[model samples]
Target: MRTVQYELMRPGELLAEKERFSVAYLPVGPLEWHGPHMPFGTDPLDAQAVARGVAQKIGGVVFPTLYCGTERARTPQELQCMGFEEEDLYVVGMDVPANPVKSCYFPEEAFGMILREYLLQIVEQGFRLVVIVNGHGASGQLATGERLAREFTHNTPATVLFTRAMQKLEEGDQRLGHANISETAMQMYISGDSVDLSQLPPREVPLKTCDWGIADALEFQGLGNAAHTVEQDPRDATAQLGRRYVENGVQRISDQVLAAYAELEPRQGTKA
Candidate 1:
């Protein structure tokens, strides 16, 4: 009912709220490039908004979002998407940044460990339900959260759930993309002042899908001709569409959180 952000609440407030409903929402995303119109923090920001909405609906506490997740290694095709010729690029360790693409990535193992520790801390704080909502579509990042949730819940009283806001939408309602229609619209709704649709590239960038398995390997090997940087077109995105996305996403996520909380109610009663 009050501020759902864990960091903003007083110790007494948190303790009282924990007794009322012991659910913690953790939002995770990457700081990757989201075209010129949207800010680089779009993923986590959108995720945090969704988490906040869910927390407000279910009386849960939302944690500070984790922005370090797996990102695609830049390849020749990716270079082209940013308007750089293949010959203009040079490999710099695991990155090939000819364009300004800001993404914070943690190795798969390290991310899993970080998630595990975060969950442990939340459980230690007496929370019985943990909801992990990710905004990034990278398989490695998504998998890390889901895997950690399964492993942690197997050995603890906490019931951890790993899911993405987009995953809750119907297939027809979903249009998951990188800085494209869905994300652009959602960001516009969440932080309208920050969004500048005029900055979108002049031409529409064609969408290219990749096999996650080979996509990462090829990028690492510098052999993929796929555009891993940008996907879909955001020229038609509007704040109204974004509001629709937020409304639908919040309802779906809140419903799931409520269901999880109901299931954990019995265990919560046993805790004290």
Candidate 2:
């Protein structure tokens, strides 16, 4: 059967599924550099790939990802390149362009407003459940996404699910951090054609010993550090490992969504 994708589904089919449970997925990623080997849009693309698989198993509509979020450029030159034409030099966070640092763009107030409107619009269109599936380094945004989800759910008759921390799956001794073996492997397994394994750089430092020096030393007065150049060597990454990560990620998210869906029922006044 053809899986439901908002971009590909016909209007009539979408209307037919109005009463049935539908999920709207939003994948958030930054425009900043990942590494020479991986495309700059790696986070968002990887996120969408995983999200599509998860949504397919859950049987819901997968919406296009929202590429803008909290991001920072790795260097002043990069930031200049990204924010070059923009009028506001200190636009902040993901809005600042090629995010060089782990800084989050979109302030709390702005995020709340934007998310609230998005959820309300989805609910108005009859999708009761919404999930913001993000694959970024910053976990704080998950809290923001969850808060918006909870607020939307409480204020309206809709149900929202945010896949925050991966639970129920063992760590499996795989590197789970940014642009590490796991993510690179998943990209190779999922988006192999788009992924240029030769571009991936060799990991100079061990994961356990690496520090958040760049983010800490930013000091709000000087240029931030560029850590995007670092990545797990693709030589050590395998398609098999990528497949395992994708499978585990999909299973974990599906389990959570199914559990959440069972507990949810639309508000009495609103239609499900």
User: How displaced is residue 99 in candidate 2, in Å?
Assistant: 9.9
Candidate 2, lDDT over the whole model:
0.58
| Candidate 1: clashing pairs of residues | none
Provide the clash count, candidate 2.
Answer: 13
> What would the TM-scores of all predictions be?
0.79, 0.71
Clashes per candidate (backbone, < 3 Å)? 0, 13
| Per-residue lDDT of model 1, residues 164-199, tens digit only | 865435665435556667787899899999888776
Local distance difference test, each candidate:
0.70, 0.58
Candidate 2 TM-score, C-alpha based: 0.71
User: Which segments of model 1 are wrong by more than 4 Å?
Assistant: 72-98, 203-232, 266-272
Against the correct fold, how does model 1 do in TM-score? 0.79
Please identify model 2 stretches exceeding 4 Å from their true place: 71-112, 164-169, 172-174, 200-234, 266-272
